[model samples]
Target: MAEEEISQISAGEFEAVSQLLSSSESLQLAFIIMILGIIGIVFGYRKFSSWVGSQKFYYKRPHFSRFVRRAVLPFFAIALITAINVHTQTGVLFGEISSIEDETISAHEQFAKILNTFNILVIGYTISHLVPIILTKREKSILEKEDFDAWFELRGFSDDSEDLFHKLYKWVPPNNAPEDIDEKEFQELLNTEKGRQYLEQFRTSKGNPIGGYEKLVDNPFEEWKKSERAKYEKYYQNCITGNNQSGRKLKPGTKPDEIFPIDVWREEKREHGYESLIPSSRPPGYAKKKREGLPKSAKQILPLGIFLATILAVVAWWGVDLIVLATATGGFSIGLGLALQETMQNYFAYIMIRKDKIFVEGDRVQLETGYNGYVHKITPRVTYIRDALNESIAVIPTRQLVNAQIVNYTKENKLVPAVVKVGVSYLNNPRQVASILVKVGKRGMREIVDTRGRHLVKQKRCPYLDKNKPSCGCDKELHVDATQPVVRFNEFNDSSLDFSMWLYVRDYGAQFKTKTDLRMIMYEEFKKYDIRIPWPIRTVYQGDEKKEFEEISELDPDRDKVIDEFGMGDIGRGEGDE
Candidate 1:
């Protein structure tokens, strides 16, 4: 089209056209044509503007208004200006005002024709390329409408809310709304101020419906089973399987489905995929398995590659002498040997860790050296322990961990066994002491009181609840119910009966507080019962006669004076020591 325009516009034709346009009548005609084009652009913009939105159907299509404003209208406007310029300047749009050698009116006219050809090409290209694209996009909007209607039908949308649906389609909810909305949920959501704000956002921003939202029409269990059956069938057909060690093969008379059911076949197929030499081997449409993190080798590979590259680059760039190269090679060999040694040691530690099922990350552990902390991370090189007492991280080499004994507080369970040892004077009855210890251990004084208060409140709120019901008929058992404290006599000390009371606590970190509380409670109980914790009694033998001190008390005010008069310190002094 552009070439034809250029070829037809000869020197005579260009002069005639320019002369005709130069006239006021011809200028007015050109202005009318431009005005008509502008009107056409406005109408086109308005016709397509309604469908443009953040919604998928509208979003897929280019905005008609933008194309008109940016491309169509601008092109016509420029063409109008070009025509006017040719009329006034003897057909040359960019003609120089200064008189130049070999510059002719015909040359200027030819230049105008060439410029017009470029404009024609651009306009023609837009028509040929852009029109079909825009036209094809019209189907998306139609399809969206059809889907919307179909969804309402499937979901049994009330006909009474037809007006509301129409309004929603015409104007989207506010931008802050969920892209996919159920009308009932939308209504309920709009009851709140936040939801109202969201709706307003959806409306303002022209939020789109979620893609395929309407298509998710069924989710029945039987239908799901059917779908799963079909999926398994596809998997069995495509995926390979191996015979069982039992040599169980379908007999000639037996049906394959009966001998090896679809469910069993599916499981076998899955196991095959997992045990395959190729990790990526999977049945068609199967979801890709997700890895929690990068493999150890993968993590190490990048750094190792960089290190090797750096060594090579340094050697090449420096152009080191033969002696230097030999020296470097020796150093490299030594370093490699050391690295291999460390790597082997770490690998052994890793094997030990796995084989023993030792404390994993997150377990509270106390190392043999009395370093108590949570296992933060376990890697081949080192195990990171986060020490709560010191509020710092302790990095212990894996080799050291493998050699040392570790007390895993919460390895098997979060609950940790805790003991509080107490000694009371022999004057107190052993049976009574043990009973008191058991009582205190079973129900921690303050903790028991709080638990009772909570239970009372719960029972009061729901009066129909059975008082005898364990854990109030809930699946969860209370921590108090789970850990019944036990008391046992440890040993008889010189002046007191030693006993240890044991109980379990949920958090391993709570051991200290629990011990403190239990001890305090036992002390109060002992004081109430007048059960004394006896001080040590001393007997002195002088001149082959033994003198026994009865009911000796450390709190006795005159004890220090008595000790001084006896000269016990001098008597206990080492021989020949001044």
Candidate 2:
């Protein structure tokens, strides 16, 4: 792949392209026409290219053409494609529209239309991230198994765990020296420059005090665990779902109680009330509520807001396009705008979203329209996302981010763990998988599962496992070796099945690369062992020919004949087959 990329495109190819554009008659005519009419399309591209050049992307180099197309195409394409779809659906299928309105496309289609606009915005946001900037890809080598394991445990771009507690702060109280040396002599060791340097990288990142610092921030995790109210809040906040383990839906307003004393919690939900009409899910219709308006995650006046946003975007582009083009030739009529109202609306919404930071570069966002991943870039009205699969980046409208439940792991904190939940067939050992996963994850991330942090999670009764929930695998789901680790079988799925366990890793910075490597390991292991990773399959038989079958069968007959002739011992003789 690397070779193909380098060999296919080079300075020579670029020069050829330039020469073709400059000398070709069609290109020359096109240039002349563009210079006379729609000059903004030409000059505006250059201006935007210049503007883009000023912004620095750490890694990727954005080409002028890529910049121009991404920026301008949305302003035009959104309105144009939307117009085509709407015009066709409205005019030609006028009769069928009413008949098929309910089921043919359903409410989801209309929602899809709205989402398409928003998806464009998401695409625009993602493009920025794809434009790589400066990156430090320095590698640290570890030879010893323990060192490698330690590196794995702390692979995340985070501080060492102990250093957080053992922050070497100021006012170094001299260490007690031997009776012959005395305390003053030991103070010199504390004053060394080397000791101060050690404190900065390890101590500061861990939020520790430098130079024998005594200041200690109160333990937030411990504090939360102690308070009765805190425990209940956490129980609900850290609620485990079957998607991660069990597929069972906890009773609405479910809280820890029957297992633990009710008094243990300061307050638990008494009524199964839906907290928000909107669900945290990215898809629009996925909201938990059955209501008229949009999901709570969506801006309150969802559909209307989307419609209005569309109009605004169309206006911005249409107006600018009209004014700019008019200066060179003629203006577009108001009738054009009216005729393309819905199209314009979608375009307008697209721009409005891109202008706002509803989601931007590096934000991990899931759009209402099915696009989900880290925002790679935002240009004009479309945003791009490097989807979770990391296969190909998806482009969506910025409006989609606004309309979707934008889950920003980095917005608040950068340490987001890309979770991998494993579910196996009946009677399969989950403990083994868990151990394998931990080892695999640590190896990939060079980080460790914070066993020390394990003690922090002390629940009276583990909510992860229950017999009644369907999410909990059938009675067959077994977690026999969980005598120590907080591992459990929570639920079942169609193909294989589910285990949920919270792993403490370095943090978010290490998460992407770590998870990627771990997933690769999983794929290799699965393939090597002939394990079937669940996926949809369909078999197509191109009418087998009896003649073909007979011909092949005749060639293999000697195998069965050999077996018949010499019993099982004949198998050893069938090695070389030309």
Candidate 3:
């Protein structure tokens, strides 16, 4: 597949196209066109020639002037040849074509043969014209991936260069220094160059004290997670559906304790007793109570008037041409199909949204296409989502939302279950690993709200006067079972013993932060226990010679350097330098 793509990219017009025209005259014309193309490539050398030398395909030199001369000029040249050949055959340049049959005339018949060759040349020209565009677009896509891979690999390396925490900050406190040092000793340390350096480090990057390096990699994965969390938080705050603590409001003058709570009805009963339920005013058919506008007989004839107007329109349309009628009918059918297709889909999607409770405003939802965001708004046609991954607004068609598998983080409850997976060396005891996980999980539990055993509090408190009424108890409360953090040994892979643990948190906003804390704590605990997070281990058996197995670094600086040189590194270098 790789070789085929390379071959396609390298393939070009000038030499390969000479065989497309068979006749001597047509062949000569094709040869002339090839020469012109060669001339264009030669003159545009400074613009695009550098692209040809690299072993990897050059998609295109994006200069409009160069592209026009190389890609567009050949098509024009072939078109001109075809036009002249057609004119020579029929002698109809800037004039009407002859209606008389010409196959009987020998000269006209021979001219027709030349015209056919020109047609072949024109088709060949069109193919040649399309090849560069198709190849260039595909090549550009591949190059973008290559550029991303290089950037991803270099992110940590570049961050290390900027990070002062490991290089200097960690040394500032001085190992085993006496905490009870006198003022004289403190002053002496302050006067030293190390103290000044420590102070200067604090001033760097606008008083960013620890200098762990501000997010050097613009990773989509991290951005997506952030956006998802932001969406969840927005939903958690604004959504009327789940975990709302505020109570619903009641209308004015309504009695809370009554079966029928309307104050007006109660007032009427108080004034007139049981007779209030029966109207005391004039009946519907009475002169004063009757509707004052159109006569009943005219109202009955209104439908006949509408039906006659429709019949007249049909009679007028019947007098139009059959061709016109057919065309109009076909066009209307097509237009109706196009409009109704989208409309019907949206209609069904709306039904699904309400039926399945797909999502509501402020709910964090991820589409099947991997676009996850807090639903900012749901309109008749499109659903607007505030993307969690990038903090951007994603407007998706309601129709598309119906087909997609929307993963709503806040669907079940505000608390999203989080899991941390780690693999330790096989040498470590399973029980020991489980114990460490529980310890880290407990540590992670600190400052994070545990949703387990938490219940959704009603938005409004019921009126005490109506406490015995069913309407007062209409508010539903949901309770979740209290769960302990669980650790499970999942799989024994080729390299390590994989284990996963589950933790519950109340706020989806703090989910990632909690995970990070757990991982960091686990790392420290693992180090203390002398348990290694193992790399993939492979064993190769040799027949005679004994070979030592060594772990290799994941990154190759030399390979990366070459790829970066060919990529958009120059553009990124300015930003990196800043």
Candidate 4:
């Protein structure tokens, strides 16, 4: 009975197919239009794909070319569909088709509208994909033009060292579990209590319980499934699959855990120890100059924004109702805004920082919060600062930088003035002390200019020299009078006359050393001239010296007994005593 019912249903479908084939001329015309539309779609796709493939840059990236071609195919299909719909309506209007079913025309129009909507989504996706690529290309061009050769070279060294480290220290499972047990099966087993019990039986090669398995058992599954664990699991899977294997082979006697000289060197390089050792490789002020020369972040962001806006415009043109879109997004927009309030503020602050030229990378700045450092990097949300006093990095929100007071030492000029104060005895000749102070200041200035001046000139950081002609001999005048050391007897203290010697150094980083040099020079010159730096001296007098002694002796009867114990017969005798 079931077989007979199926046969009846098949017959009905076959009769329907036959009826469609023998339908009116209008139906046949619609069928022909669809077939032609499909053909046009195929032809248009081929032409578009070929054009994309012919472009030199796009041709090199076949995957990207294919993605772009696939993305654009929906638009081509929609256009052909629209054409077919237009032709069909024209036929009906002119009576070329004696009659057409309203439902049939309606279905065709609906299908075309759906394709148009799909095409809008495809366009939006294509623009989103292209924006990053455009920004990356612009950034690469900008970096290429700037002097980041040292930074790039350092990065290359780091990558190579990391590669070498991985090779030297190959990762193995905690325990040498049966090689036959698939990692995937082991992970799946972890989900079940019985499976976990089974895994707990296997011991590590070291003859100890599996540490990782123990950790898994201790922590709740949900907590263990957080992002950090997920990342570790992914990394472990990659390691097990040999995806992270470096092709380099080990030396004849090298163990997997062996530390090599190259590894040590790489570690030092990572810590910037190598850069410090080879100062000539990295020009002074390289970070500062590179930051100054970098194209503004706006240059990268503005074009991407415009491109996205154009995509939105195309979506709007495709008959997406703005009122509906706004209403649908209103709640989502409010939630997102609340969630990203701090993020938005930071981004705006980053724009302000760049626009106002408040500070750049390598500028030594002290924030109102007493965070002093050189700006290492500037991102939309966070600014990384390398501490001036140590190797630590301070991560400051960009908004903090905008809202807080900052003292930027390298904003307008690299040269910064430093003062050294000294106190001389009041009896010492003020003019002579002043002369020695000025002399030491002059000597310190010469020493700095001679030692660091050449480097500053090379870095184009010399304040006295023209940036265009760094070797114009104009800097030589700085040694004589351009920025001569100034001396002022600024204060008079109770014990001494305080004098301040003011001098200028190349930059903030040099100020400390410069001050030290000047102090050492002053010490030597002061000793040579027999100038005394005084200390507090106090002299106290009581009523009269003899009377005070007599009163103290009378007050203390033990004084005579103390003198007799020391075998002194006469105690407290004066000059007139007999």
Top candidate, metric lDDT:
4
Q: After the best TM-score superposition of candidate 3, give how far the Cα of residue 18 lies from its true spot, in angstroms.
A: 84
Q: Per-residue CA lDDT of candidate 3, range 335-416, in tens? A: 7889789877876786678678778776877778787678776665777888766668987888887767778877767656
Clashes of each: 9, 83, 11, 0
lDDT of 1 at 202: 33
Q: Candidate 3, which ten residues in sequence have the lowest lDDT sum? A: 465-474
lDDT for every model? 0.48, 0.38, 0.47, 0.53
Predict model 1's lDDT versus the native: 0.48
Ranking by TM-score: 4, 1, 3, 2
Model 4 Cα lDDT, one tens digit per residue, 209-294: 34241222233223322422233334333433444444232221122211112222222343452222221232333334444634
lDDT ranking, best first:
4, 1, 3, 2
Candidate 1 TM-score, C-alpha based: 0.33
Off by over 4 Å in 3: 1-348, 351-356, 448-478, 507-509, 536-578
TM values, all candidates: 0.33, 0.28, 0.30, 0.44
Q: CA lDDT of 240 in candidate 3?
A: 24
lDDT tens readout by residue for model 2, 1-578 = 43444334323222333333343354345334433443444466566655553332200222333444455634543444454446445554233323222344343244234335444553444343223211101111111223323322222102223433233222344345434333564455447765333322222212222234343445422322233233333343332232212333333222221111122111111111101111112222222222222212222224345455555454353233433433433223465777876556556665666456455566776655666577776654455788767898886654444556666655543333355555554333333444444434333332222322111111122222221111111111122222122234567665555654333322344444544555676666444323334443333546455654454345344334433432321112356732
